[model samples]
Structure formats: C-alpha cells, structure tokens
Target chain A: MNDAFSQLHPAASFAFFVAVITLTMLYMHPVLLIISLAAAAGYVCILKGARHFGKTLIYLVPFLIFMSVLNALFNHAGVTPLFYLSNGNAVTKEALTFGFYASVMLSAVILWFECFNVVMTSDKLLCLFGRLSPSVSLLLSMALRFVPKFGRKIRSIDAARAQIGQGSAQGGFIRRVKNSMKVLSVTLTWALESSLTAANSMKSRGYGAARRTSFSLYRFTVRDAVTMVLCAFAVGVTAACVVSGGIYARYYPSVIISGFGGIPALGMAAFALLCFLPQLFDAKEALVWRRLRSAI
Target chain B: MPQTVKKSRVTVTLTVIVLSAAAIAVETWLWSSRKYYLTSVIIILLAMLPFFARFEGRRPQVREIVLLAVMTAFAVAGRVAFYWAPQFKPVCAIVILTAAAFNAEAGFITGAAAGLISNMFFGQGPWTPWQMFGFGLVGFFAGVLFGGREVKTVPMLVYGFFSVLIIYGVLLDTGSLFMYSQEVSLKALLAMYASGFTFNLIHASGTVVFLLLLQKPVLSKLRRIKIKYGMLQ
Candidate 1:
C-alpha cells in the first residue's frame, strides 16, 4: 500500500500477483500461510497506516487461527503422523503441517486480493477486461461497488418505515414476522418504482446504443513491462517450484528439511517487490492525498 | 405507452422462445454428442422468463419475480455443486425455506433451477434433467405454505426438510439411473442407493444447517435485490 511501490500500473501487476499466489498454493509451507497472514496484516498496516493495523489485526487474526485449527481437525491428510485418532486415523505430522501451510497460502491469496481491491478501483477494473463479456463483467463489477450501497439503502428504508409506524413491532413473534414481510414487500415495491425510473432514464439517454464505450485512463509504461516480466519470472519460478516440490520443504517428525528455505523465500520476496513496484513511481497521488488529509 | 410496453414484451417473448429453442438445439446436439455441457444456456433462459414475459392478467411483485429467478438459480446451483459429494444430499434448501414463506411454485422453481444452473461451474451431463425435476419438486411443495402471511418460516423449515429429503433421495436413485450405460429399473436403483440413507442423513443435516443460517439473511436481502435489479412489472 504505502510501500511507495504500490501505486504503479496495477493491471498486470495484480493479475500477476493473483497468479503467483494461486500457483504457489499448489506447493507451499505451513510457515508460508503464517507468513501470508502476517503479510496480510502487514499489507493492511502499510495501506491505512500503522494506527489502524490494530483493529484489522483484531478482526482477522482470530478468524485465521480458527480456520487453521478447523482445517487441521477435519483434513486428516499428509504422510507422517503427529498423533493417532481414537478411531485409529493418524494425524500425519505432514498432513497437519501441510494443512497449516496451505492455510498460509490461502491467507496470502486472500490478502493479495484485498490489496488488489484497494489499489484497483472500479475505473481501473473496467479497463482491465476490455474484450471479454463486456456487459456481464460491467454488471458484476458494478454489483461489487453497488452491493454495500444496496444494503445501506435497505437499512435506511427500514429505519424510515419504523419512524412512520410502518414497522413490524407489535403482535406475537409470528405476527410481527408477518408484518415485517409486508413491510419488506412494500419497501421492495417502492425501490422497484425508483429503479424503473432510473431504467427509463437510461433508455431515454440511449444506453443500449452500440456506440457507447466504457472508458478509463490508466496507461501502461516500460517499467510496467519489466515489472510484468519480473513478476512472470517469479510465477514461472513458483510453478517450477510447485511442480518440482521446491516450494514446500518438510520436516516430518522423522523427516527433516534443512538448507532449502532461502531460494523460495527469495523468490517470494522478489514477487512481493514486483507486485508492490507500482507504488515506487507514483509519489504524486499519495503526496496529494496526504496533503489533503493534513489540510482536513 | 403501456401499449408499447406490452408490444415490447410480446416481441421479447417471441424472441426468447426462439432463443430458447436455439439453445435447446445446441444443448441437444451436445447431449447427443458428449452427453454433458454446463446447464447455463437452458437455466439462463428459464431464469429470464419472468423478466421478458408481460403478464397482462395479474403479475407477481418484483420481489416475487426476482426471488423466483434467484430461487430457481440457487436450487439448481447448490444441487449441482454438491453432485459428487455423498449421496442423498441437501442443496437448494434456500428455495425450500423461501417457498415455505411464499408458495410451492416459488420453492419448486428455485430448487429446480438451482439444481440445473449450478452445473455451469463444471459440466452438465445426463443427470441435469433429473436433478432439475427433483429440485423443482422441492420448491413446489415449499411454495404451498398454509395460512402463513407475508413471512413464513416454520412451514418453510418443514417444507425445506422434507422437500430436500425427497429431492436428494430421488436424485441419488436417479443418479444411479444415469450412471448406467443402458436401461435399468428405478426400483432396482433405489434398492442400490437405499444403502446411502446414512449419507442422505449427512446431506440433509448439512442442508438444514445451511437453511437455518442463511434463511434470514437471504430473505432480508431478497426484497432489496429485487428492487435494485428493477425486477418489477
């Protein structure tokens, strides 16, 4: 985020990052999941500033921990046993370890996407997929931006209804539920009326015309190319690692892995750098935002 | 003018019928050749019917219209997603729950469509039509909630449980039917899948859990989804 390398051309970088994380999931470490979780935390901290990291940490840490534990319990996988089940299934040390590692991979994938979400705004996204099912993509992307607003509008409508004594507050739980249904139905009708108005407006404005184009401004540069190449190189390395089993070095209770972490770790660090490289060149926007905030 | 709206709707219907026919043709070709493709083309046409059709008589509310489409899509999708899982599975409990709130038609459409469309993620095969029928039945029963007002839950849950039970059970038997290379009796297949009753229990329990957790959220959101999407008549 604020790593000064984050504000760069984001399209290829984002897809590149997602690709690497997804591919790495094919072969990764329990340590890597922890690292990913940590990186997620770190990435958030970098974005919103260290002050907000505490709140983010509070919310995500517990969930990640819970997921890790649940995966370990349910997914009795791996080659070496750490413990024996009462029904005689062994929790292979490898399985438990791999589960934990996979969790890290999952965390990385998630955090990486979150980073994309923050950096790649809707305007950027529209530009990214210019060729594919344009309508569907536009609609889905709009939904993403609009869904929260949609939820908010409903809440506000309900609150307004309550103010007008239209709420389902009386009678038994059953009756009250019935009333809520009626209220929701009425509210939905009102909402639809408004939507129709909007749609008609769109029709009048010639929204269905073939000439209309969704446009955005985010140009690609030479650095973007190098960054892409570097990222792709990392992706290739990640794939090569997974296929060759270089990504996950294991120590079964009986089997130990040593002297193997350095290369993959270096590869990941290189990727993180490429993914964040955009920020390094774009000082103006961040600086302006900082200035605006200071003035506020 | 309202007349133009009617005309437009009529035109859309004729177009949809043709489009649907075309899609079915494509599907039939695939079915004949590979016996499997995703259920997108058919499920989509089914989902869009209310949107395109102009009911001059009486029309369902926008919520009903959207929910109908969603319920169709959800039931089909959920069933398809869990296809390879243990037999006698519960999916599309949402449809059951919602239909119980509303009526049998809603439930049936949701379950049927959900079963059919969710296959789009993977491939649709010989089992699509059977799953479609199975889920559609679940929704149909759910939609028949007795004496419930705008909001119905108890009936929804009951309907969801039983409808899902039948849907999943029949699906298992029917699945066995499809898995066969040639002709086989339903009774024989049912006997074979009769052993999967435990798995059915597992599936039913899972669906019930999902229904309980998701019903409130989905119901609350359904109205809003209708409004936002301009699914009103």
Candidate 2:
C-alpha cells in the first residue's frame, strides 16, 4: 500500500502508461504480452511484497478462466473443434485461440492499469489540470476523488441500511427493486451535493470569473522532447501501415502492403517512449522527496 | 498601417479559405470512400468557428470544460471499447440530458466533440462524421425540448427514443453504403436495423428511461452550475 501510495504521481504514471502502451502496441506478440504479464506480477510482488501478489493470483485466476470460457462460447469461429458436441456445434479451436489471446490482452492492459491506478492519484491529476480549465479540472479531480470517497460513504450507508433491514442486496427481486429507488435517489443526492460543494468552492476561489492559468507538476525535459519526436515517427509509421492495408488483411496475403508491420513500429515507438523512463522515475522520486522534505 | 490591416484581413480570409479547402478535401475523400452524412462534418466545422470567435473570453468556464472532458472521455472510451464492451449509450444520454438542461448549441458542440474524440481510439477512417452528426443532432435538439426543464415526460421519451433510432440508422446506412458493402440498399440498411431491432429498441428505451430518471437531478444540478459559474448568459 505504501508503494502503491508512493506510485500515485500522475506524471510518472503517464510516462509509464505511454511507455507500456507504445511497447505493447508495437510488439503485440503473445510471447511479449506473457512476458509483460510476468513482469507486472514481479513488479507487484516487489512493491507490495509476496503476500499481495498471492492474493491477486487467487482472484485473477478464476477471472481469467471465466473470461476465456465466455469468449470461446461467444466468438463462434473456425471449424476445428477440440471436442464434438451432441449437436455438432463444438467449440472451435479458433474461438479458443481468440479467447486466450483476448484474455492475455485483457490481463496485460489490466496489469498496466493496476500500476497506473496505484501511481496516478486524483490529487496529482487535479493539480495537473488546475491551470486552463479550473472548474472542469476541479470537477474532474473531484469526480475522481469522489468515486473512492463516495464508495466508502456508500459502504457506510449500506452498513447502516443493513442494520435497519433496508439493504437491497439481502432482499428479494421486487424488494430489491423497491430498495434500489432509495439507493438511486440517495446516490443522486450525494452526487448533486458534491457537485454543488465543489462548484461553491470554485466560486469562492474566483474560478471561471476571469482568465485562469493551470500549473503542471510535469516539466518537459530534453528526454521528453526526444521521446515525443520518436512517438511522432511511430504515429506516422502506424498511419502509413493502416493506409497501406498491412494491418487489415481480410484474407491472408490478399490486402498485404509494405513496412515491418504494426507490431514492429509499435516497438520502435515503445523504445522511443521508454528511453525517457529513467528521467520519469527520477522526477517521481524527486517530487516525493520534496514533499517529504517539506513535511520534515 | 493599411498594409497591416490588409494582412490581418488576409489572415482571416486565408484561415477561412484554408478551412474550406480542408473541408472540401475531407468531404471528397469521405464521399468517395464513405457516405453523404459524413459530409455534414464540413458543415459542423464551419459552425464551430463562429462560437470560438464569439466566445473570446480570456478563460473558458471550468464547469463547461469539465462537462466536455467527461463527455469526451466517455465518447472515446465508448468507441474504443465497442467490440469488447457496451456502447457508451449512457454518454449520449448524458449528452441528451446536458443539452436538455442547458442549451441546444451546448449539446451539439459537446456531442460532436465527443464523437470525434471517440473515433480516435478506433483509428478514424470513414464513419466519424456521421457519428458526430448523429450525436450532435440529438444534443442540439435535447435542449430545445428538455434543455429548459419545463417538466414534461411523455413527449421527451418519444422524442429521445426516436432520436436514438434515427441516429443509429443514419450511422448504419452511411457506414454500410460507403465502406462495407457496395450494393448498400435501404432494404439492407433496414434489415440490419431490423435484425438488431430488439437491441436498438432496448437501447433507445433504456436511454429514455435513464434520462427520465436523471432529468430532475441533472437539471437541478446544472442550474446550480449556471447560477454559480455564469455558464449561461
């Protein structure tokens, strides 16, 4: 939790997301995603220690299996089924393959997001946007902040409701439906009150009455410039690939075009993006130290 | 002095001309490869300029920006997650609600921007313009009917439901005709809608229900925003 809390620096998270996405998009091989999945697991263990990692696997494993099964059942492609059904509508190998691929993709994305969720705290995002669009930025940050806070409030509300025998989940369908109206009304009231408070706070600060300026914690350095240049190249290359029909072949070899393909370009972009990772990490460390130093 | 004035005038004229050219080029490409409704983007882009020029406030309203960003995020996320997740039907409903609670123009701009933003995730090809038009149309009119909060339900429900179906139909017809199938006919278009009739019905009905449910809360809240932030003149 300390590690996760420390990681909640939006700039660092942004850099991490940019790097991971660029890399994963460019090198979308099953092998790479698997490696990423492993790497993510390793990082989690390192940060939260072995106990949390173990906790994650127990829940994640069942989810992965469920996702795999659901995708296979629904996809309905390819004729090579592993087992023959009584109706001869057996689950195809392709569907199963797609399912696994989909699962892997989903897991990889989720893993990165877990890291992101840990690092990019709401305060950081709010601070980042406080310049140009104060009201909106405040709303955004507040919304993000409110979600977790509201969630806690709702849990408390639920506990109170449970004591009163007013909790919907414990009741029958019709009763639940009747209870849901109360929940919805309560939640809506909460949202409205929150928005109003946030708006009032803005008004008190003279928000949106005059020109507002935003300040960003992130200072774009030389590394950032180099990284951006590389990303631009990657974007160009991807657009070229799309235009050339290399990425969208309906049938094998029919709509084939030129270039090292989608995955490779994504790699170069990732490489470009990742080249700035050291600076990102350093910046994140410095910010934390600054905060600590100030506190001290 | 006359030359600088001439230059500024020239710059304005040039900006207009360049934008017009871009619109023409985009429309031509879209028409050749996409659909008629797609060309309406050119029209919307033209519409957007006047607002920017007119609303030359030093800073934009925070509430408006926040609303736009949320809608935009939903719009982008919706399309990005389309094949894998539920359509951001809720986002459009929010758009509908926002427009109804505020101004028609607000809805149009928000809807259009949200649609455009959403297409970025899908890697915009041909269908973007029509989707924008669909969302924009819903939003622009939502304000006309519900934007003011006169407190009518049945008319809004009927209006919202048909609006959704029309938007979906427009999208399907444009997309199918221009890109997917060459022999795209109205019958084929209708058939597609018919096949997904239940889904469309549910989607439209659900939106109407959702908006109706949120109408009171959303309107009251937006009124607070306006009063607090001077969002409306």
Candidate 3:
C-alpha cells in the first residue's frame, strides 16, 4: 500500500493531499466530515498499520471529547438547550453538535498530515520545489538530512560525557541541566566547525557557479496523469457544490442543516471519491500483485 | 559582492514588510467574517513568501545554504535534546543566535525549517503552521532588531523573554481559540490565554536561561566563523 502510493508522481500525491486536506478543513457538513474522517483513518491504517491506528485513536478520542465538552460549556448560542452550566450558560445541542463537527475536522486534518509526513519524503519535496526555489529547496532537504545526523552526534557526545562522569544523569536536577547545557554547547561548536568544511566542500564542487540541476527518478506517467485529472475533477466539483450552497449547515443561533439532495449528494460522492482515491490505488495494486503471485 | 548582498537585503526586508502588512489586512478582513481555514492558509503562505523572494533575487551560495541547514538542524536537535524538560527547549535561543550572527533571512528560514522538520517527529497538525509562524517571527525580529550588532546579553535575554511569550503565549493560544470555538469572543480569548499562561512562562524561562548561558559562547564562535569565512556579510 505504501509502495503503491509512493510510486505516484510527487505532483499527483501533492495535489491529492492539497485537495483532501483543504476540503476536510473547510467543508463543515456532517456527511462530508464523516466521510473525510473515515477515509483519513482508513488510509492511515493502510499506510501505518493497525497499531498506529489504535494509538492515534487513543490520543484523538479524548481530545475530541474534550473539545466537544469545552464548546458545550462555553457556547450558549442555540435554541435547543440540553442543560444550563453553573455559569448560567445553556449547554445547547447545537453547540455540542458544532463541537463534534469541529473535533472531527481537527482529527481528520491531523490524520491527513500524518499521512503526508509519511508520503511526502524529503526527496519528493525537493523534487516538487527544486525547480521553483532551488536554494530554499536545497536548504530544506539539507535540514531534513541533518536532523538525524545531528541526533547521532548528540547521542555520541552524551555517551562520551557520561563515560567521563560529567553526564546529565550524574548530578542533581540543576547540575544535570548544567551538564546537558555543557554537552549542548560542545555540539553547537562542533556543528559550526563542521559546517565550514561542508561549505568548503561545496565550494570545491563548484556549487552556485551556475544554476543547479538535479537528477530525478520520478516521471509523470499515464497513471499519474489520470489520477491527477480525477482528483482535480473531484475537487472542482466539490468546490462548485460548496460555493453553490449545496453542502450547507448552520450551528449558531440555531442548528440548521440544509436538506441532503441532488447537488449535495453528488458533491459528497465526489468528495468521498477524492478522499478514497489513494486507497483505491492501493487496493488495485494489491489485487494485481496477488493475481500475479497466484499465476506464478 | 557587498553591494549585491546589500541590495538583496533591502529587497528581502521590503518583501517581509509588505507581505506582513498584506497578511494583517487579510487577517483583519477574515476575522470579521470568520474564515479560519482561509486565514490559516493565507498566513502560512505569507510567512513562507519572503524566503522565495529573498533567494530568488540572489541565489544563496551553497556554503550559506549548508550553514543555514546545519543551524536549523541543531535548533531542532536542541528541542529534542531537552525533551526531558517539559516546555523547555533551546530552540528559541538557537534561532535568536542564528539570526543575530547571520541575517534575518537566514534566521526566518532556520526557524521555519526547524518548526517543520521537528513536527515530523512531534506530530504535525494545524498547530504546525502557527508554530512555524511563531518561530519564524522570533527569528525575523531578532535579525531586524539586532542584526550585525555587537552582542549584549541583557538585551538578548529580554528579547528572548518576549519572543517566547509571543510564540507559546499568543500564537499557539490563538490557534486553540480558533480550533475550539466557532465564533470569536473576548471572554474565550482571555480564558484561552489564562489557561496557557503557565506553559508560556515555562517556555519563556527556558528561552531566557538558554540565552543567558549561551549568548556569549555561541555568538563569539559564530562571529569568529563569519570573520574567517567572510560569511553573511
């Protein structure tokens, strides 16, 4: 599943994320919210496995509940009063429902970002932005690469310090903090010195002598083109429907939801398709692989 | 070379001012109408536009790029290194030092890049953009206020104190306010700020401690490196 999604052109993948995440954040209709949440969760499970799904749910459920409760307590702008808070504000059904919608939206967006972190590899990001902003892209990719390298350096430094009995663990709280700062200062100095050599290496390589060119493995293939067109079509239709007031809901003063009918239904179907496009690709790839395996 | 550098610096400064002004105008309009999603997207794009403008005018040498990347990475690593200390990280101080030693442009890029890359491990969400903005502004102001100036510990510490307040106090609190409420209200905003005050204080103290302890050594080393390499001139 991961391989299937990763194999798509970076542009296509980026478009898919932009479309789904934008809609997930903007579209407040209950139907669209549910669809987005389910699709985001399903895709996350496919990409990250079930263990991560459980972990995310554990964190998100409480947060969702908390948000809903907070809104129910504070916001009293509704006709349907469930109860009155001690502050004399009514805990209205409309507020609770709105809170629930917000929670779902927040969770769905977070899930999409988690998927994005997995799918949008630094190299792919570089590929996407390199042509548009070469120096910024270079810096971004370099920063991404250096994070883990710096982490390793910190660990090694910590180990060296600990062996000499001046480690963070070898003292009281204040002393430990001081010790850690010592290690951090050393790492900062080392990083600065090493950067000079790095700069010199680039200088020797004739970097910035001319506009830089990079080797790219990704190509916009037929599949990528089709997927992008499909995604764009779905996004366009959904946006048109939204602008046309097909997917409309009101949570303040009164909880009013527009009737689900022709255009709203079509818009929802398109949105669901948009959110599920990656999963569809993953499923198709798996089926093909399984068939080929059985034949062999 | 110096002229070109100065020209680009002027252009970068102008772009930042223009974009921020535009963002403020957009934000005012959106807040009145309550378009939170659009506000988020617009602000993030606005925050990032200066980087492209700055680099587009004059392509940064690979040396500067690598150095900026390494500094960003160190800032991020510093954040993770102090994970044991809740709400306390040297990231803000590192960003301030980077901006002071280098330029505002490098400072903004380093802060933004660090916010983004660190969120990969910490978890990315809507808060990510606000975090990036908060940190980026810290770097930008540091550069704007203290760029190419002699190091003074007291002023740096004061700046660090306020920068942390803006980041953890104002920016993130506003994010929660929007996330939790459909409609904006003064009471809710006050409540949100009150709730987040303790955490912001911790973050502020962390920034101050890191600045007080690190400003001299880090700035001196970076200054010496700049002289030796003729960098960020």
Candidate 4:
C-alpha cells in the first residue's frame, strides 16, 4: 500500500520535510538529535522496505564514525583535553561530544533527504514549480523524456557495433573506452539529426506561443491543510523556544543544555510529534487494515 | 534580428551579473549565520536562474530548445553508460563540446539539464544543487572561453581536465564539507579535499579521455548541424 502520509498533498509532505530537515540541521541538543534521527530512520523504513534502510545504515554508520573522529582530531577548541596526539592537538571532550552530535545531525539530514527523494518525486516537484518557471520546467521535462530514449539508442548502437566485431567488451581498458566513444559519437549524430525533426514538430504544435497550463494529480484537501498547519505550529514552537533560551546548548568550551522546563518541554514534545508524524500516519493505516481484515 | 540578438545578450548578461551579485550578498549573510547548506544551494540556484530566464524571455526557436535537450540527453547517457566506473563520466567533456560548438547559454543549459536529469536516475539528494551548479559553471566557463571557436583537442582536453578536477571537484567537496562536516575549519576543509582527491583525479582523467577521443567528431557533427539548421547563430 502507498504509505498513508505520501497520499497527502505534495505541499504538505514538502513542508513537513523542510521543517524537519531545517530543525535537524539547527538543533545541536543531543536529545533532539536522537529524536530526529530515530524519526527519520523510522520514516524511511516505512517508505522503503527495512532491508533497503538497513543497507543504507550499513554504509552510513562507518561514515558517521569517521566524521566524528576526524572532527575531534582536527578541532582542538574545547577546554577539557582527554588526550594529546603527536601533532599536539589535544582531544577535548567537548569537541568530541560536539563532533558526535554534529555527525548525528548530518546523518539525520541525509536520511531526511532520502525520505524527501521518495516522497517528493519528479512529478511532484514539477507540479510545485511548473508555474513558477514554465521554461525551466519545460526544459526539465523535455530533457528527462530524452534521457531514457537516449539510453536505449546507446544500447542499440553498442549492439550494432558488437555485431560488427567492434564491441567495447573485447578490448583492453583503453580500447574499450575508444570503442565506447565510437558508439557515443554515432548516438550523438543521430540525436542531433533527430532533434531538428523534434524542433519542427514542436514549432508546428505551437509550443511556447501561449501561456502554459500545468495539470497535477494532487489536491489540497482538509487533511492536507491540517498537516500543514500542524507542521507549521510545531516549527513555530521549536523556533520560539530556541530563541527564548528555553532550548539552548553549547559545546564549545563545555557541553551545557538549558534546563528542561515548561516551555522547553512543550517545544521538545511538539518537535517530536512533528518528526514522528509520518510514522504515526503509516501506523494508523496499518492498524485500520488489520482491523478490517479481522472484521472480515 | 542582429540588433535584437545584441539587445537580448545585454539583458541576459545584465541579469546574470545582478543576480550573482545578489547571491554573493545573501551568501555572505548566510555564511555568517552558519547556514552553509542553504547558503550554497540558494547561491547556486540564484546563479542558474538567469540562464533559465534568458531561455524563457528570448522564447528560443524550437530547434534551439531541441538542441539543448539532445545534448543534455547525451551527457546523461554518457554518465549512465559509465556507471560501473565510479567518478568516471563524460558529462563535462560533452558539456564542453556543446558549448564550444554553440554558445555559452546552450552550454550552461545543457550542463545544468544533464546534472538534474542524471540525478533523477541516480536519486536526488542534498548534493543535487551542488552537482547542478558545478556542472553548469563548467559549461558556462567553457562557453565563455571556447564557444564558436575551433576546439583544438589538446587545449580543450586540458580545460576539461582542470575544470573537472577543480571546479566540479571543489564545489562537490564544499558540499560534502557542509553536509558531512558542519564545521568549516580550514583543517576540516583540507581534510575533506584530501579525501576527495583520488575521486577528483579519476573524474578529471575520465573527462580528459572523453575529450581526447570524442572532441573531434563531436565538434564536427555539432558544427555540421549548426550549418545545416542555420539556428543558434
């Protein structure tokens, strides 16, 4: 089943991700970082299967650790020195902690972008920006349409070459590269030659002679409205709390987090809700399906 | 027609200069605020806007649009064909050839389009804008330097090599810096560049190789098409 969250209007999903990613980048608080990271992972697992998510994690975890260690080694800015390398750069606790959290922030952002890719498809992006810049949108659509066609053409050219004993596969690396270039050259000529016909066809069709109208499959329903409003409210609360010093952190000379109080707690809760909103929707949909099956 | 062409050229140039200046201003502010990713992405997008605007305002001939689309598709296809060779793609070389055969505007549009479309197959990420900007800048510069000129294989190959190594490589490394290492210390940046050096070298070599092999044919064909269509003049 299509995830319940992705069924919302593109605007809604786009807004939620923008808010979540922005917050993830800005917030340095460990608790908030963990919450954002977990939420991002969970959302991706729901969107793509857990196996794919796991493969991504296997690649990302080492990268995360490497960045953290590199940061600690290079940045000697903090007060509490844990050790000193031969290069005389003291490994400070604050710097190490800062690096770890910063890496976490980076990981969370990457995962969120993964989710963004899944949810904000090319069609959705085209729909969102089509009217804003019709020429750019048209170029994107045309170029995208041609990419697959060109790929197929390249394959055909390669096959024809192979039949003529000029396959890229039978040679040394340099020879293979040269043979491939031969195929590409043929494709290029054909593409350029065919483009004239395409242009003539477009001209005859009266393209760009009038203002363009775009059609999108998505509609902003009441559910989408609620989602947008809730996301905005959560972001607003988080921003306000951060500005008011209710949610504050420093990891330069030392790690200091502001006391968890009424406003700060509320802000954290709101942020958490915003992060897990997609998962909640997915879970609700699963539960509904379960109940329907049981009733049947 | 010549007068109008000159007029549009002036407007496009003016648009690019003004938007770039504004982008620099906003980039300074965002950099100060440590909003690295947003700053870079916004700056790149702002820089690219004028090209798209020029295409729109000029209401280019159908052939012009088709030429741009075809070249972009070629670049994307080149990239896909060499997917097994990491960082070894002919995108830059193709962009350079397109620019040299046509004008800078065509080159920039082709490069930017290729970047965006290729990423559609590869999956878009935070790196998309950077890749788009980097590839576009390489094409833009190539057009400015070599457009409508005889593309000597050696000089063109040299340009492709250094450009892929420096322009595209540096921009992407800066992207990695912002995304992976939020801290923008000189040391961190150096480290990042160090890690990225081999990849950049491979990418640059790939461009040089492609340029060496494809430059003569690509240029001749493109020029032939230009003569045949009598468009993009």
C-alpha lDDT of all candidate models, in order? 0.53, 0.56, 0.83, 0.85
Scored by lDDT, model 3 comes in at: 0.83
Using DockQ, rank the candidates from best to worst.
Answer: 3, 4, 2, 1
Give the runs in model 3 whose Cα sits over 4 Å from its true position.
A1-3, A158-179, A290-296, B1-33
Please provide, for model 3 over B1-233, each residue's C-alpha lDDT reduced to its tens digit, 9 standing for 90 to 100. 58887887778677767876776686676332355655655766665776656666576777788888888888887787777998898888889999999878878888888888788668767677778877888998899888889878788899899888875479889887776566678898888899999999999999998888788878888888889889889
| Residues B90-130 of candidate 2: C-alpha lDDT, one tens digit per residue | 55676787687677866776676666555433433345666
Q: Candidate 2 docking: what grade?
A: incorrect
Error (Å) of candidate 3 at residue B157 is 0.9
Find the candidate with the highest lDDT and give its number: 4
- Candidate 4 chain A has its poorest 10 consecutive residues by lDDT at A252-261
Off by over 4 Å in 4: A170-178, A284-296, B1-33
Residue pairs that clash (backbone atoms under 3 angstroms), model 3 = none
Ten contiguous residues minimizing lDDT sum, candidate 1 chain A: A138-147
Cα lDDT tens digits, model 4, A1-296, are 26899888888988998899878887777888999999999888888989999999998999888978978888898899999999888999988898888889888988998888888888888888888777777778778888888778888889989998788786788789789878877888898888788888878898778887788999999989989999999999887877777888888777787848899998899899999999887788799999999999
Native contacts recovered, each model: 0.00, 0.06, 0.76, 0.72
Model 1: CA > 4 A from native: A1-10, A29-38, A55-92, A141-164, A169-175, A215-217, A221-223, A241-296, B1-233
| Backbone clash count, each prediction separately | 40, 11, 0, 0
lDDT of 1 by residue, B1-233 (tens): 57877787677777777776676676566322221122332444454454323321233433344345434433433454356875434455666655555555555545654554454333343355566666666666555553124556565566556655666566645564333211235554565477666666676677776676567755556545544654432
* Ranking of all candidate structures by their lDDT, best first: 4, 3, 2, 1
